[model samples]
Target: MKRWRHLALLLMLMTLALLALPAYLERAELQLWLLGPAWCG
Candidate 1:
């Protein structure tokens, strides 16, 4: 039972992180786009 609870918590955190990753990447990409090619180059 204790192990199941721990696994559940880990799974929840992983799910949240996975869901958040794309949004985070999109925000980062948007910031980079705003910065422009010359700035990145």
Candidate 2:
């Protein structure tokens, strides 16, 4: 539903931000960005 889509978008943005950071909050952020679409889908 709409909520899921919104959450997915938010996570996508987080993933992008985390990816662009020189020091990430966690290394896993990269994996989340790489796989978020499949996981979200």
Candidate 3:
């Protein structure tokens, strides 16, 4: 119900972020941005 809609909306926003992020940063930087936090631990 309402929770499903909220989850769907969050997923859509994440997909949009993925699509829009590449245009804002270089491929290498983008990879680092995605992986940086994991490597920090």
lDDT of each prediction vs. the true structure?
A: 0.95, 0.85, 0.90
Best by lDDT: 1
Per-model TM against the reference: 0.57, 0.51, 0.57
- Over 1-41, each residue of candidate 3 has an lDDT whose tens digit, in order, gives 99999999999999999998877578778789899999997
Residue-level error in angstroms, candidate 1, position 11: 0.5
Q: Cα deviation of 3 in candidate 1 (Å)?
A: 0.8
TM-score of 2: 0.51
- Point out the higher-scoring one by TM-score: 1 or 2: 1
Task: Report residue 24 deviation for candidate 2 (angstroms).
Answer: 11
Per-residue CA lDDT of candidate 1, range 4-30, in tens? 999999999999999999999999999
TM-score of 3: 0.57
State the lDDT of candidate 2 residue by residue for 1-41, as single tens digits: 99999999999999998777765545578879988999999
Clashing pairs in 2: none
